[model samples]
Target: MTTAYLYVLHGRRGKIPESNLELLAGFIADEGQLGRIAFLEGDEQTLEDGIRDLQGRPGVDHLAIVPVLLYSATHIRWDIPERSAKVLDPSITVTVTEPLAGTAAVERYLERTLGAAVTAFPGRRVLLIAHGTPHFPEPFEELKELASRVGRTIGVEVVPTNHVGHPTIEETLADEHGPFIVERLFLTDGRLAAKMKARVQAIESGDVFLPTLEDDPVIINAIRERLAEAGV
Candidate 1:
């Protein structure tokens, strides 16, 4: 049997979320298995085609559909599995794992990223920006706890801000002073990151750090570690 693992990415159409893809790729690469790894982009056609391909592969005994998302919202918990069943083989054993937000590795990544921001800002105020979801409380709360932990560790005051929901960027920015630095807490350079840059531009005295998806090796390593923990 081939024992291949199918890594499925869940998100909106046209947006692949390269950072998550890169992270997943890194983990698979580190495992030293090339042909055994497969990717499925999010979309109706792609999801169906990917599952069909997996089913046709004679060597694939187990299919682990890992959701490349941050939260366990409707998409990760329900939509992905529903779509998978459309093409999945009954003989094959398939398992769905939780999103990245459920891992402590993500919290560690956030700590390291925010710690660097705190060190750079020194006495200045710092804002950690996250892409929030109103329906999912874990992502926001995990990000907030990360900010608090990093603040306590570095002995600096750090404020956690969300772009879409509660503790919004506007609300957090309103209470902050000048010369602040806004560090993006997202895994990729997408709409959220772009909005954060625009929000920082409106602030007269603050600066923003635009780190690319490949900027931090710690995050890459963390993803690898998480995958190992998952026995992937």
Candidate 2:
């Protein structure tokens, strides 16, 4: 059976974010697989639209959907599957790969990004930020665990917080009076990320802000690993 890879993510209805997805699709396509991009939210190409487009292609019998998400939360575990199932043809098999929650590539990226901050500040705790969900706490919990693991390796305390949920970035950094590092787990440099960046800026000064993940190789490799896990 012929399989096509679909890179899906939360859309922000902007050209740059869409371009980021296009770039990711290009990288995956270089691996000799047919690929497409879709959005789960916003006004861009929808997941249903992408499925239809792929189904229209000749000899495309199966779809390997790799959600470009940071964690295996509601969108990965429920939304994608439900949305894809509704539009998929019975003859076409579909596999929704796991999100990039605990991937080694991500861990490496975090370590490399935070290494400098730890060196500069010595014993200061690092603030790890993620675009968290208010409906479910799994994403926040998962990020916390990931932070804990990375903290152990780097010899520093990695404090994880949701920019939108409980233990928010605002509250976490409220009582802080020293230099700190803020590492974001956001995938693209979109509107949401911009809002979080502004929040960080307003909260403190001299707190180092690590770069956001924008078409980073770690993300590309994580997506590749997800496709591999699904046997695509």
Candidate 3:
């Protein structure tokens, strides 16, 4: 019997969103021969504990760590592997796949999310608000490129804005028209999510539409496809 373990890696937040985790579990059950489903938190000790638990499971043949992250940052590339090695047996075949970045599915998801806002208004400005990384600028740039592509494809004016790093909401909202839509590009509803909604609401001139993470089917499908590709 082939026993495959689907391990989802959490980020600095120390916990994965229940919705995202549910989506991942559903994908694994639909695709691979799942032996055991395990959730690993984002701490050093918790990750080790999760790996050890998996290693101790009987009849386990293959172990795969799928990170539910947006980019291939230091944590996904280095920290996850280093921590997993401490508990994994050397004989076991282990594979760590890339995070959800540069995938056509993800691009499609972003396009659809922004496309909806564009369709609402014929010639108005639409902004794709994303959680930006200060140290690494690749994700922000990638989002910007995606927004530009979507705008050109749909023949609408759209701009990608970041909240944490440069080109902030203030900068993006400057010189913009009334009735703006701030689409939150996130996988979970955490502190950042709340803060984003509040900031948009505080804008006096325009109306903001807050779409929940569950509303975007494209994102859900993209995550499913990413897991399927990893042989989950």
lDDT of each: 0.64, 0.80, 0.64
Off by over 4 Å in 1: 10-12, 15-30, 34-45, 102-104, 210-219
Q: Candidate 3 on 169-193: residue-level lDDT in tens?
A: 7776675555666667766676777
* Residue pair clashes in candidate 1: 2-59
**Candidate 3 runs further than 4 Å off:** 1-3, 7-16, 35-46, 59-61, 174-178, 210-212, 215-220, 227-232
Estimate TM-scores for all models.
0.78, 0.91, 0.78
How do the residues 109-129 of candidate 2 rate in per-residue lDDT, one tens digit apiece?
Answer: 888888877897776778888
Cα shift from native, residue 28, model 3 (Å) = 2.7
Q: Per lDDT, what order, best first?
A: 2, 3, 1
Query: Which 10-residue window of candidate 3 scores lowest in summed lDDT?
Result: 36-45
| Per-residue alpha-carbon lDDT of candidate 1 for residues 1-232, written as tens digits (9 for 90 to 100) | 4445566554456544545555556766876642222334444436666667766776776766665556666667667778788778888787566666546676666566667776766776667777776777777887777778777876777788788778777877788765666667656676658878788677645575746334355554554555567665
Deviation in Å, model 2, residue 141 alpha carbon: 1.4
Q: Arrange candidates by TM-score, highest first: which order?
A: 2, 1, 3
User: Which candidate tops lDDT?
Assistant: 2
